[model samples]
Target: MAALTCRQVGNDFFKEGRWREAIDKYTDAINLDPNDHLSYTNRATTYSKMKNYTAAIRDCKKSIEIEPKHIKAYYRLANSLKMLHCYDESLVTFNTFLGFEPNNNLAQNERTQVKTAIFKEKLQGAQVHPALRILSWANCDNDPLSCKARLLAATLEFNKGNEDGKNRNVKGLIEITEGIMLDERCFIIPSSINLAVNTAFEQNKALSPTLSVRATILKYKQRLAQDGWDSVLPALATNIRAAFLIGYMSRFTPDVRNIDQGIENIRRAIELASFATEIAPVATDDINSIDPILKITFLRTLKVHLMEAILIKYKRNIEMIDLFDKVLQLAKEVIESCNENPISTEDTISYCAYYRGHLEEAYGAIGSAYNERSKFSRGELGFQERDLKLLLESVKNYEKANEYFPSDDPKFALFHYLTASYKLMIGGCTLHEIKQHAQKAKECEKEAYPVFGNYLGDIFEKSMVFQALEQLKRPNNIASDDKYFLPQACHVSSNSEEEEQRFIREYEARTGGTIAATMDLSQAAARANAEFLRNGISIISSDKQ
Candidate 1:
C-alpha cells in the first residue's frame, strides 16, 4: 500500500531525528489515505516536536474527527495547543485523555499545570490598596501608610492563593513583606521573598512591565540558590520565575501572557505537591495551601499532550521520574470529575495517592471514606453515589492494578486496595477474610512486580502497561486525619427538603435505641429482683427443714 510506504518513511524519519522530514512524510501518508488515523496522528506528533503548533493541532484534530478514539491525536493536539498557550483548548484535550485512561498521571499533572495558568490570568486585574495587598485596601483610606501598604498588600496576596483578592485580611500583605524583609537571607523561604519582591515591584503600575519582570527575575535568580534540597530547587525557581512573569507581564500582555504564566504556575504547584509528599512533617502550623493555584489549561487535548510528555519524553529521561510523580499528584487533584454526594473525596485522594506510591496514606484516606459512607444522608448522595458500584469496581481495578503495581513504584495500588478492604469491612463484608486478602495483596505486590518502566500511559505506550506485578505487605498505621481536601459543602449543592427528612431519620436512629433501652430498664429490673427474692426464701426454708 502506498499509505504503508509513506507511513514507514515517516516513522523512519521520526526515528532518524529528521522531524521536519517526518512531518512531511506523515502529511504525504495522510494524503494517500485520508482515512488513516495513524497518518494524521503521526504528522501531528511530528508537528509538536517541530513546535509547529498550528499544523500539529490541525492534523491531530483531523485524526480525531475521523476516529473519535484517536487518543494519540488528542494528546498531540493538546501539546501543540499548550506550546501555543491555548490552555482552555488544551484542557479539553487532556480531559479526553483522562476519559480513556483515568489512571494516567501525566494527564492529571498537565491538567493542574494548565489550571494554574488559567488562574494567573484572572489574577491580573487585582485591586490594590494598603489593606488589600492583592486587591485595593479599602479601610486604610485615612492612614498615611495607605499607599505603600496597599502595594505591599497586593504582592502578599498574590503570593497566597488569591487569584484576585489581595491582603485585605490582617495577615495583610505587609506582614509577608515584613517576614521577608526582617531576614534578607531568609534561606527558609527564597520563593516567598522572591514572590513578595516581584509582586511589589510589578504592582508599581508606574513601571514598564517587561523591564520590571526582567529585573525581578534577575534578583530572584541570585537569591534562589539559597533554598535547600538538591533536585527540587531549580523547579522552584522556575515556578517563582513564572509568578514574576505573570504579574509583570499582566500590564502589557493582558490575558495572553497571564495564561502562559498560569500554565507555568500550575506546573509549579504540582512540583510543590510532589515536594510536600516526600518531605518530613514540620511541626509548625502551615495553614497555607501551595502557592499560585493556577488554573489548568485543561482541555481533553492538552491532557493527552502532557501525558505523552511523561510517558514518551520521560522514558528517555529517567531523571524526570520525580517530575512525573508531581504530574501524577496534580492530575489526581483535578481530574476525578466525580459528581458530589456519596462519591467520597477520601476515595478520590486515596486513588491519587495510590498512583503516587503513598500507599499508607491512600489506605487511610479510603478507609476514612468507607467508614463515613454510612454518614451521608440518602438524599445527599448526589450522582457520585453511583460511584459506590464504581468504587467496588475500583476495588477490583486496584486488586488487578496492584497485581502489577510496584511496591516502590509510585502507583500506590496496595494502599488503594487496603483502603477498599477497610471500606468493605466496615460495610459488613467479610472483615477477617478481607484482612487476609488485604495482607496477601501487599505480600504478593512487594514480592513480585518489576519497576523498570516509566509512569503509566495507556494510549500510545500500551506495551509498558501493567509493569509492576506486586508489592510487599505493610500495616496501615498512619492515623487517619479524615480531613477533606475538597470542601464537604461541595458534596451537597444545598440540603433540600429530602435531605432534611433523611437528616431526621438519622437523628432518630441515634436517639431511639437509647430511649428504648432506658424505658425497659426499670420494669425489667423489678421482675428480676422479685424472682431472686422468692428463690432465696425457698432455698432458706429447705435448708432449715
Candidate 2:
C-alpha cells in the first residue's frame, strides 16, 4: 500500500522529468517494502533515463530476483547491458523477454538491434559473411550507430569483393556517410573515409588505396586540418595508413617508393598517437562509443604492414633474416600488449595470427627461392632437398593460419591452395596423393571465388583443370600416370574426397537461398571437354582453309 503510493509519486516525478526526485521516491518505496519488485524496476528505469547503466542494471537484477519472469525488468536489464557493451549478455536477456512476450513488436525490433550490434563487434575483429548479411538486412531501424557500423562493414566487404564484379554497389556507404555528416553529433567523424573507399573502388585499386593512388589520404589530411586532431583521430589515421599498406603490398608487384612514403606516414601517425596519450590521461577511454584500445591496435596493425613491406623488398635476399627477426620481435611485443589490455576484437587476434603465419610462409618461400637462385649464383648443393624442406615448412605455416581463421573463411582457400602446390612440388608422393591434394585445393579455391571475387582462386582451379586435361591427353606426369591407380592404402584420396563432398554440401545448404547452382565436377568436366573440342575444331578449320 505504502509501496504503491511511492511508485505513483515516483511515476509523477518521472513524467515531470525530475529523475533524482523519482529515484528518491522509488528508493523510499524499496526501503519500506524490501521485496517490492515494482519499486526496484521503476528506480531502474529512472537510472537508465539518467544514463547510469551500472546502477540501472543492479536495480533491474533486483527486480528480476523478486520476480524471475519480470518482462519489463528483463527489457531494462538488456538495454543497460547493451549500453555497457556486454553484448552477449544483453542478447540473452533480450531473448528471454521475447520468449515470454512473443508478439511484442518493440521487443522484436530491439532484439534485431542487439543482433546488429553483435555482428558489428564481430565484424570489427574478423570478416564474417553472415554478419555482413545481417548488417545488410532490411527493416533495421534508422539507428545512427548501426548505420555507421553498416557503412564501415559494407566498405570493407566492397573493398574485398568489388574487384570480382563491376556492378557491385558500394555507393551506399558514401551516401550513408553523407547523410550521417549532417547530424552535429556525427559531424566530427571524417566523412572522407567512406568517400575515399568509394573512390578507391572507382580507381580499381580498392584492395589498397595508397595516398598517391587515391586522393583519400589527401581528403583525410584536409579534414584533420580543418577539424583539428582529437585523441582518437591519430589512432584512426594510423589505422587508415596501415590499411593502405596492407592493400597496396598485397599486390603482385608493389612500388618501393610508394611503400616508403606510406611507411613514413604511418610512423608519423604513431608519433601523433603517442603524443595524444601523453596529453590525455584518459587516452584509452571510450570516445563516442569507439574503443580506446584503437591506438594499440593501429600500432600493431602498422607493425604487420611494415613487416609485409620489408618482406616484399627482401623476400629473395639472403640478408633478410636480420630484418625479419627484428619485425617478429616487435610484433610479439604488440601482441603481448594486446594480451595485457586486449582492445582489438577476435578479428584482430586472427589478423595477428595471419601475419605470423605469413611471416613463416615468407621465410620458407624466400629460403627456397634463395636456395634455387644459389644453384646459379652461389653454386649451393642439395637445392632439391632444401626445396622440399622449405615447401613442407610453408605448408605447415599456412595450415596454422587456416586454424586461426573460421573454417569456411575464403582466406583459408589461399592456405589450402599453397599447401596443395607445395605437396605437388615436394616429389616422391604418389600420383593419387598429389592429385587428391590438387583437387582439394582447387575446390576450396572455387568456393571462395564469390566472396573475394579475386582470380587467385581461378588460378588454382585452372592448375587442377590443366592437370586433369593433361591426364587425359598425355599420361606422362604424376597427375596423368596416377589416374589409373586410386591408392586406397594412402587414405589421402578417400579422406580428401569425403571432406570435399562435405564442404560442397555445407556450402550448398548455407547458400541455397542466394546461389542458384554451385559448380561441380560435372560442370568442370563439361567445360574442359567443350574447350578441347573447340581447339581441335579450330585446328581442323584452319587446315581446310
Clashing pairs in 2: 125-347, 126-347
> TM-score for every candidate vs. truth?
0.25, 0.41
Write the residue-wise lDDT of candidate 1 on 440-464 in tens digits.
Answer: 5445444223211222223211211
Residue-level lDDT tens digits of model 2 in 1-545: 98889989999999999999999999999999999999999999999888666678889888999999789999999887776556678888889998999898987898888899877766664343322323222222223222223333333333323332233334433332222212111212233444444553544322233344235445544555666556235434334433443333333345656655555554544544454344333543443243332445435544544555555555545455675555446545544654554432334332222233333333433333333332222235312223446456555656555554333344455556655545544433333454555556557655444333343635743454334323332112224322322121122333455654554455456556233144443333333333433343221111110
Q: Which run of 10 residues does model 1 get worst, by summed lDDT?
A: 464-473
- Best-fitting candidate, scored by lDDT: 2
Model 2, residue 13: C-alpha shift (Å): 16
Full-model lDDT for every candidate: 0.40, 0.50
